[model samples]
Target: MTEEDIATASGLPVYTWRRRHGADFRARVPVINPRERLRLYDAAQATAYIKGAPIPASPADDAAHPDDLLSDKEAGVVLGIDATTVRAYATTGYLPPGTERHGRTWWTRRSITVRRDSPDQRHHSPGRQPGDLRDRAPRHRRDPRVTEVSALLLLGQVTTDEIAEHYQVGRRTAQRLLAAALTVSED
Candidate 1:
């Protein structure tokens, strides 16, 4: 049925029908092509029906854009570093301060952009390689947590709650620590 017929039968105004189905109706109506119908309908919708409509921007245009907002993972991807390294750098003051709340970290795209543009930012050295022993070495030789968890795991007798209570960490963290220790011992 025609939009006019719909509006008439439904007791709504013809302009309402035109606003809603003017394009499609124009397409099926005699003498009107799809493009002309679409244009007319878009005009009607823009001028009479819609409360607020956005103007279309140019597809080919390039503008001075702001840096994208980034999460830790996204910032790490942009900086070509691992998430752990990014966190370490942020924690150690190598990078500028980022927003921190409830144990989550967030960085602005501008932060990374500015850091990349800065002249004083140090690039990794080419000649000196980090040691393989760094990965395989014992915990006391590396992380301070090593001494604490190693003693508990080596005893092989502590409950998860006991470990959590002793370390003042959450039960989940305690479980993860235990699992990691077991993996290291097996390796």
Candidate 2:
């Protein structure tokens, strides 16, 4: 089949498929036979094909008990804090110590659930209290790096960490700066 015929049959942009496969594309199209193509189209019409579907919990899949450790991200979601905050809490020894294995750290999912459910639990708490000590910071202590970095990025100049390093601050601080800047810009 001609290049035009191949493009029409495959429903791909002619230039892209041709550039990708080169001359071999022409030879393979006839070998695969257009029957498979038609079958694929029919399948597309009959059922939706989803990529990366979450595995359904089966009868054999037991609910993770309260003692099960979770990842920092999962714990953060349960505690309603950002992933960075969760990491910070872990670093500060606020959260129950997690175990490192397979190059990853995991918290007990059970421990998280218990902390979340307990009235006396104190780790990974979200939201600033009314009497938060951070409120005592002077107005001059406010960092403007996130704003500058985000503005520069929007203008296609610098990246997130570039701005952070420029100000000698952590990347998370830079990100928070950007988020705050975006919020203000949106308002």
Candidate 3:
């Protein structure tokens, strides 16, 4: 259906549909095919776009704009935030950093929009996946030495002086370590 047909079916006046929020919605609609002077759109999909409804995937969408890419500023608009904020978030691991192409960063619409899916319900933290223990990192942090020292300090079986002697540290340093361990155990 044509834009006018959509306006009429949606109970919006043609002029209103051609302006205001409806016009903004049109900007998001993939341009109608044939690259012609006049274009056509799938009526239901166009209406869905205007109504803020989820659009089902379609072949036409895949065919259009094969090289579609948004610059940092355009991505910011899609994300409803300022450009500088988008740039910072993308660079600092907060948002997906778009590909650096032709000496500039460009983002696909999917990269920015996919982040909106059930974000707060996520289970694990981002970055490296769970797996093997590299030599650089311990298999686990359960060092018996630390556990024994912490236990001795907690049970009053050891004092700052004794801890200093065993660990070969100054009395002041042992006292500080004991105090820190106490505070952590409280938490």
Each candidate structure's TM-score, on Cα atoms with residue i matched to residue i, is 0.30, 0.32, 0.30
lDDT of 2 by residue, 1-187 (tens): 3354445556668697568653653332222124323211121211121122332222121554565445676788898888788777677666766887435677888767765777754544565777898877666554565466557657775556876787777988767777776765576
lDDT of 2: 0.57
Question: Model 3 over residues 114-146: C-alpha lDDT tens digits?
Answer: 654437423354645567344256564443445
Q: In candidate 3, residue 166 scores what lDDT? A: 88
- How many backbone clashes does every candidate have? 0, 9, 0
Name the lDDT of candidate 3: 0.66
Worst 10 residues of 1 by lDDT: 32-41
Error of 1 at 61 (Å): 13
- Per-residue lDDT of model 1, residues 100-131, tens digit only: 63345767777877766767544552333567
Residue pairs in collision within model 3: none
Q: Which of 2 and 3 is the better model by lDDT?
A: 3
What does candidate 1 score on TM?
0.30
lDDT of each: 0.58, 0.57, 0.66
The 10 consecutive residues of candidate 2 with the worst lDDT sum are 39-48
